[model samples]
Target: MILITGATGHIGAAVLDQLLKITDPGEVAGLVRDEAKAAHLKAQGVQLRVGDYRDPASLERAMQGVRKVLLVSGGADEDGLQQHYNVVDAAKKAGVACLAYTGRALQNPATLANELMVRHFQTEEYIRASGVPYILFRNILYMDTLPQFVGPQVFERGIQLPAGQGRVAFALRQEMGEAIANVLADSRCDNRIFTFTGAATYSFADVATALSELSARPVVYTPIEQPAFAARLHAQSLPEAVIQRISGFLTDIKNGQEATVSTDLADALGRTPASLQEGLPTIFKL
Candidate 1:
């Protein structure tokens, strides 16, 4: 059986959907923390296994009878690395055949110089040492998360961020989901790292133009100082730790960390991945 962690989430759900098409639904198990959120998946004949990354016993139970597992990376918390270790330890103990992890596209040195990348690298190292065949999907930034950078006042207050002229190879989240599912289904993808990315790169200015075109509103990209940006986020009631983490992301972008473009995703999916222009409409609900 194939077990997927975070199955109720966007990437997990998409992977589940794609997996169901090529495999028997009963052969797949979804590790979920909330059964209520997994109602639709359960109704579709997917086996629901209650599990939490922080709970090793639960993961051990979920991994029973599971040959392969997709260990989706946890959220941006200080405990995330430990949680990932917990999953890896459980997977090792359960004798899982293959373990796939979703991580960041770390091409530039600038990208690796942040707390986010540090944690990912740590997890990758741990996974490698776990004695299981693994696939690392080093994904680029998601175009779906552009709204967080553009802010809610984009149409009215225009766009503002600390990222200055930094381009990102932003891939569509759903397409990424499909690509990940494709990897899990194929045996040849074992013990490899895939850089899942879009066909093109876009800067914030380009993003503003796209938003302007899509929303038919005057959207302008304004470069702001990091301190000012932090202050603004603070005024909005964001935690200091969260604000610092977000600022570090912007710092990486400003340093041109996320600018690399790769065709690995296209090669994996057997087609050119969607660019920002084609994906913007769907993401912004235009």
Candidate 2:
């Protein structure tokens, strides 16, 4: 049996969808924190197991009879890391055969976002040290981020960012999830680190241009200083920590740190991932 954590989330839900079509419902289990939020998944025939990453006992119960585990990273920050470790420990005790984890793109030890990368590396290390077969999907930034960042302003104003002319290899979350499901379904996916990306690389300006075309408005890309950008986000009632983290990510983008694209996802899924154009309609509708 295969167990999927974070089953209510975007990528996790997509993974669950793909797994259902290829595997029997009885062979699939969903580890979710809130059973109420998972009513839809339950209706779809997934065996629901209520579990919280902070609670080791819950994880053990969730992992019962599970052969493969997909450990989706929690949403919170440092506390989330601890929760992930707890889940890994429980998975170890449950004697799961293979564990798959999500990670960042850069394998390089030196980079601005390397700190985030390190956390994922630590989880990967734990899975490896546990003597379980593991697969690491080093995912790129989500193409969905474009809509989240700019969609709100589509009708009122335009998009603005600190990413000066930097390019990013952003893949669709659905595609990433599908690639993950493909990996989990195949026995040969053990002990591999696959870097996932879209078919093309895009700059912030390119994103604004696409939005402009889709919305039929003058979508402008404005680059501002990191401190100023953070101040703006702060004025908008965003948490200081979130503002700082976003500023740091934009700084990394401006430094050309996230420009690499890969064919690994296509190779894994036997198909090309969705493009920005294909994803624009749904994103713009919101």
Candidate 3:
């Protein structure tokens, strides 16, 4: 049986959908914190196991009889590393045959988001040390995040953060999730780390142009200094810590650190991943 944690999340749900298409429903288990939140999945024939990363016993219970486990990272928190460690430890005790984890793409130890990367690296280390075969999917930035970053400005004033001409290889969350499912199903992917991205690279201006084409509105890209950008986000009611984190990420992009596209995703799925243009309509509902 395959146990998928974070089954209610964006990528997790997409992974579940893809798995259901190729595997028996009885062979798939969804480890969710809230059983009520997973009623739809339960009705769809997925075995529901109540679990949480903070609670190792819950993960242990959910992992029982599981052959494979997909450890989706917990969302924005300082304790993300600890939570992932708990899940990894539980999986170790469960003697799962294989494990899969989602990590960030191109996260260098010296970069601004290095702390997050370090946590993932640490988790990978633990999984490897536990003698369990594992696959680490280092995913690129999501095209869905573009909407979250650009939508408010478009609705209020039709502006976007012109982070210069730097390119970002962004992919649809569903595409990444599908790739994860493919990895989980493939027995040959043991002990591998795949960095996944879209089929093409795009600059921030390119994103603005696409948005303009989709919305039929003239969206303007406004480049600003990192500090100024952080101040703007702060003024928009974002918490100071969040503003800092986002600004740091934008800085990394502006410096062209996260631009490269890789073919690992295609290799894993045995098909080309989706491009930005192909994913635009789905993201913008155009």
**Candidate whose lDDT is highest:** 1
Ranking by TM-score: 1, 3, 2
lDDT of 2 by residue, 16-133 (tens): 9999988888888899989999999999999899999989999998998999999998774777778878988998899888888987775354667435546777777787887878
The Cα RMSD in angstroms, rounded to one decimal, for candidate 2 relative to the true structure is 1.9
lDDT of 1 by residue, 1-286 (tens): 8889999998898889888887888888899999998999999989999999999998998898888899898898778999999999999998888888988886664345367677777888899998899999898988899988787778999888989888899998888888888878886536899888888888899999988988889999999998899899899999988898888888888887787788988987789988778998888888
Error of model 1, residue 124, in angstroms: 0.5
Candidate 1: minimum summed lDDT over ten consecutive residues — where? 106-115
If candidate 1 were superposed on the true structure by all CA atoms, what would the RMSD be? 1.5
Each prediction's TM-score against the native?
Answer: 0.95, 0.93, 0.94
TM-score-best of 1 and 2: 1
User: Candidate 3: which pairs clash?
Assistant: none
Q: What is the lDDT of candidate 1?
A: 0.87
Give the Å error, residue 30, model 2. 0.4
